[model samples]
Target: MSEFFAHRRPGRPGLAVFVNAGDPPLALLPELVAMLDENEVDCLELAVPFPGSATDGPVVRASADRALATGVTPRAVLDTVASVRPGLRRLRIALLADWSHTVRGTAPGEFAAAARDAGCDGLLLHGVPPRLRTAHYEAVRRAGLPLVTTCYAVSGPDAVAEAVEHGSAYLYLVAHYGRSGTAAAWDRKRLGAVTATLRSAASAPVAVGFGVRTATDIEFLEGLGAEAAVVGSAGVARMEQARAAGRDPVGELQSFVRELRTPQPSHTPADGRKRGIHP
Candidate 1:
């Protein structure tokens, strides 16, 4: 395990948030990351924007579109992450790249090396074809970068095996099969067995995503034997809403992160408005 997860103790179920590289604009991203770090976000999955992601829903897709419209490239994303890494005291960044759109032209080993040099703690290659899995795994191994492997909660044994075997930094156990963060409700009985299976097999930390919105959900995941709960769509949506309302995007996002970490059943900010973090 990388130092990122190595230092995380068995308390405060890890909170990982996702954000597009340039959605808040590259210039302001460092500030956002700083806010996340100060507010105790365990990890940030920084994505290089691409179109038509199969796992993304409207909120995330719109965030990606906003980022791509500003002409954010994969290299630019790395540079931006590198700039924030020095200042981060706790937050670890995992570079999330779409394999076809962002990494197809680059050599796998070269891309992995670039991410490492940019101070990323881990690399998550999204939308990778199964036939090319060996090459991707080898590249990360050669670069000595931690790998964040993912599989759906309902995936077959082969998929589960692949994730557990290669996953070093963490394992992203997606909660459902549909687009990310679109599930109406979680089936606790079904997920309990899956979470238990992953915890038993994976040496890395197990973090579950998909429809994980509130602290209640986070607590529930912890209860189910997961090490962390990942909130993507809701996190991105908070930033967009802040931007639209002419509020401080980083400050607003920090508030959302604070809500997730708090152990209260009813989360109320200073303003006392009830915020729903649904995807």
Candidate 2:
């Protein structure tokens, strides 16, 4: 099993936090990773910025813009990961990038090799569907790194199965059919159905993302049988908010993560049985 999925507990959902590489500056990455590691963030996703990212929302786009303006290239992101790996002893690190950023100008094999050497345990390629992932899979396989893929609710059962088959680490299920950051309310009924389908088909742990924001959301995901909950845009928004207020961004992020992982009270159902917040 991949280290990412191996860290998940059966009933409690793991927390994964996303941060864009070199968002403010690359010099701060090691400290940020160390803080996250100290706070029990199960996974750290280092998002590599590209000019044309279809999956990014306004918050993430702004972060990417700031990083790009400072000349944060793919090579720089990898080097930052390599430098910070020793401090992240208990955290599983994954690199999030599109195929364009992964390939750059070299072959996929060469790109995957560099990422593995940089201390990334897995890779998540955004916007690539499962049916079209054979070449990417082979390249990463040759490099000895596990590849993670996304499965959408609209993709239906067969697509979910195919995604699970192609994905070696874990499968990311889009909680809603949209971009990264949106204020739309989550449909619990629909999410339950989708999670049921995915759990039936997926052999590895299934993680939900794209609309998760709060501790309540994490509890809901745990109720739906999701192994992990990914918080992306909200994390970046908190960091940006702290920076604008002249407060320490890392401290704000640490508090936000601690709040997200804190358990809430569970309510009694119609059966008159009390259940905890998590499954």
Candidate 3:
């Protein structure tokens, strides 16, 4: 089983934290990574800063801007991962989508290979492109890198079901419609229903993201049968706040993870069969 899958089975949902490489500084990234690992994070998603980030809101976009200001590129992010790779055991690193493809060109295979060589375990293509043209997704998966594709509420439940049928290594469910926030804007009841339908059809793990800023947000997803919760803007924003406050940023992060890992009562799905955690 993949490291991601292995972490999600039979217990609680895996917490996948996202960090923008070069946000604080490239030199500080490895230490930040070590902090997350010490906190027992299941997987890490490293955002390779790009010039443009359409899917990201103000918080993430601002961080990306700062990273770009520091000249953080895809290569820089890979280098950071390479330095910390040897120290990790059973950890998966997923590279965020390439900016160029989102705006300019087609998906870049070489870019994916570069990330793989640098010890990245997967790829996260942010939005489900209009004409998905699964060629590149297939290429990266063939190379042993699981490509995660997201389906939002606006895409409708049918699209979500179809994504599962087509074989997403992981199906990203956007619970919230807009910017990352302290409270979830998504309709919990509706999202739960959609999640139920998707889980019934999806061949892969269904992970929730977007505006999932707190442990409470996670509890909601777990209840809905999601196997993983993606926390990005919240964690990154917290990391920045810690830095600005002159606190031990890493220590603070470790504490945050502990809160996330706390056990919660599982919810029985609508189908009556309890869904196993997606390790």
- For candidate 3, give the lDDT of residue 97: 64
lDDT of 3: 0.71
TM-score of each: 0.92, 0.90, 0.83
Instruction: Give me the runs in candidate 3 sitting further than 4 Å from their true place.
Output: 101-108, 127-132, 165-168, 182-184, 263-279
130-228: candidate 2 lDDT, tens digit per residue: 464777778888899877778776777677777788777777888777778976556666777888887787676688898788887788788888889
Q: Write the per-residue lDDT of candidate 3 for residues 1-279, one digit (tens) a residue.
A: 255646654657877887777887888888878776666676787877765566677788888888789977666778888889889755667777653533135344656677778888777765445564366666666666666667775677566755675545577787766665434356656777778877887777777888766676687678778888998888778877888899866667777787777765656667644222221
Model 1 off-target regions past 4 Å?
A: 265-279
Clashes of each: 0, 0, 7
- Which candidate should be chosen as best, given TM-score against the real structure? 1
Clashing pairs in 1: none
Cα lDDT listed for each candidate: 0.84, 0.80, 0.71
- Who is ahead in TM-score, 2 or 3? 2
Against the true structure, candidate 1 reaches a TM-score of 0.92
Ranking by lDDT: 1, 2, 3
lDDT of 1 by residue, 1-279 (tens): 245544455676887899889988988998888888888778999898999998899999999998999998888888888887888888989889888997888877788899999999998999888899998898888899999999886889998999999998899998877887585566666677889998998888899898988887887778788888889998888889999999988888888888887786655466643332211
As a whole number from 0 to 100, the lDDT of residue 203 in candidate 1 is 84
